[model samples]
Target chain A: MIFDTQRAIAWINRIAELVRADVERLTTLDTAIGDGDHGANLDRGMTAAVDALAEKEPETPGKVLITAGRGLVSKTGGASGPLYGSGFRAAGKAMRDEGDVVALSDALEAMLRAIEELGGAHHEDKTMVDAFAPAVAAFQQAAGATADMHTAAVAAAEAAEAGLAATVPLQARKGRASYLGPRSVGHEDPGAASTVLIFRALADVTAE
Target chain B: MSSSANGGPTPPSVGIVLISHSAALARAAAEMAAALAGPEVTIRPAGGTDDGSMGTSIDLIGTAVREADSGGGVLVLMDMGSSVLTAKTLLEDLDDDDAPAVRLADAPFLEGAVAAAVLASTGADLQTVAESAEQAWSMRKL
Candidate 1:
């Protein structure tokens, strides 16, 4: 059985809340090289998107994500905004027609398209793409092998975290970290770090 | 919290808009807002893309603003640079009834989210809430 709109919303909410609790830490990392609002900006964007959804309460998962995508697009004014927005928009597109279950492949395709269309960045670019790419690929592979969304989500979350950790030694090519050159090497990509949080939320929610 | 849908006597509930250049930032912002905002206020985020050609489409953003405003005012927050232009475009796209009085938030991210939520919870108008957010952001060192 696949999770539906309400479950998805709950997952998003949990992720948002977890990130909110850590906004200060995230921004501190951003403060080192970037504008320092990474955590604050993301927190604001997610909060706003959730509020919009609560007010409108779209009946379907597609509508919910679409509403969220639009909200993120307008509210977040940084590099990550459109990428995340487009990702949800892609996910929404895939889930436009729903049954009892949402296929892992459909979710993967939508998220990949969203990242590609919005950021124009690729895997191993030392951005969130680093984490997202690995997570999606792992999720797809796991899902293909087994029809368990919960297991797939958990595997993806782990892969995402591992990918995020791997970014520590990689050279920066995207976002503000690119400007820092060698200085960007040791620090974790904030975007990748946050994506892991999101995937973890999804996994936890599904497990429940 | 009690909120009035457009044209009500109570100070209209504030609406939130987030503008960022990063998809991760946008996602993170949306996640933050949900944690802080109460049930009455409406928050929406618009993410920017890295491609110079790609941006938050004004029409699409305006629709969200209009929908959230519901005859109230909207407080828009942007990360930097082009986000200002993007917010302006979104405001221009609003229809008469759909468009609420649009205010640009001063506080960057956390500060803005907190201020917006406080004002929204208290039934502050878009302009006042936005002004407060700006003050909070401007005074901040980082």
Candidate 2:
């Protein structure tokens, strides 16, 4: 199933709902090694994204993502805001007018690239890249195998979840968590966990 | 202080923008730096998220940078983590022509802002102000 503009908006809104539901859990994950505001900040951003999308009702999938990104940047504070905003913005640019499986793969790849470029973080740094990188890879591989968007999204979501879990026991090398050094080894990265939710939302939407 | 050649109000040679996670913290730091820099320097506090929560805002920082600039340039002093990321992202978004000669100082937030502010108040150029701020990193308090 190819994702259109409406579908994309719905997916993002669904992610907002999921994020709102998991706010406390995400904040708990953050409190262990971070500033403990990840969930709240992201919830604010996602809520704003949904509202902005609903108000503008953009015509293309790309436009919807871009509007959502802008909303996040403006509404969400902290490093995550700019990082995630850049990712979504890049994905939107990469998607252009195409909503095929290949385009989705390219968009996810672009999102990862933007996050890395903006955040100066790489895979295994115990950042969102941990989840996003594997998700992008899985998406690209699945896109290569078939044209089914749902299949690729499922693969990506599963990879992201695994990556999120893998962040535990890894010492943070970037962000505020890095200040803890060895103390950060036992906690899952809040950013990576949130990334999993994003991919999962994508998969859920595509499956529906 | 020297007025403009045309007898108009003269702006400082450089401006300072303090980026912090807390709005009140940024404002207080800016005020402290302003006290040291005198009333000549344009010191703007671009802190917290848009809703006055704790976090850095790229839009707020960008706006503060523009507001602080008075033809000399702007110097950005960030607290840590996301503040630095947001400031750099804002710079990347600016067009070359509209983008001033802005520099993000890798110095201690309060000390750096104060040092940079004082330097700019003395009619120092943008580079000199930024260098002075960076010099604060080496200040030993032990």
Considering every candidate listed, which one attains the maximal DockQ? 2
**Top TM-score prediction, candidate number:** 2
Per-residue lDDT over A11-90 for candidate 2, one digit per residue giving the tens place of the 0 to 100 score: 89988988999999999999999999999999999998999998879999998888898888878886788898888888
lDDT for model 1 comes to 0.71
lDDT of 1 by residue, A87-139 (tens): 77678767744523335457666887767655656766688889988888888
Q: For all the predictions, what are the DockQ values?
A: 0.05, 0.74
The true-versus-predicted C-alpha distance at residue A177 of model 1, in Å, is 1.1
lDDT score of residue A67 within candidate 2: 88
lDDT by residue for model 2 (B61-141), tens: 888989988889999999988898788778767767967778889899999999999999888998899999999989889
Candidate 1 C-alpha error for residue A94, in Å: 1.3
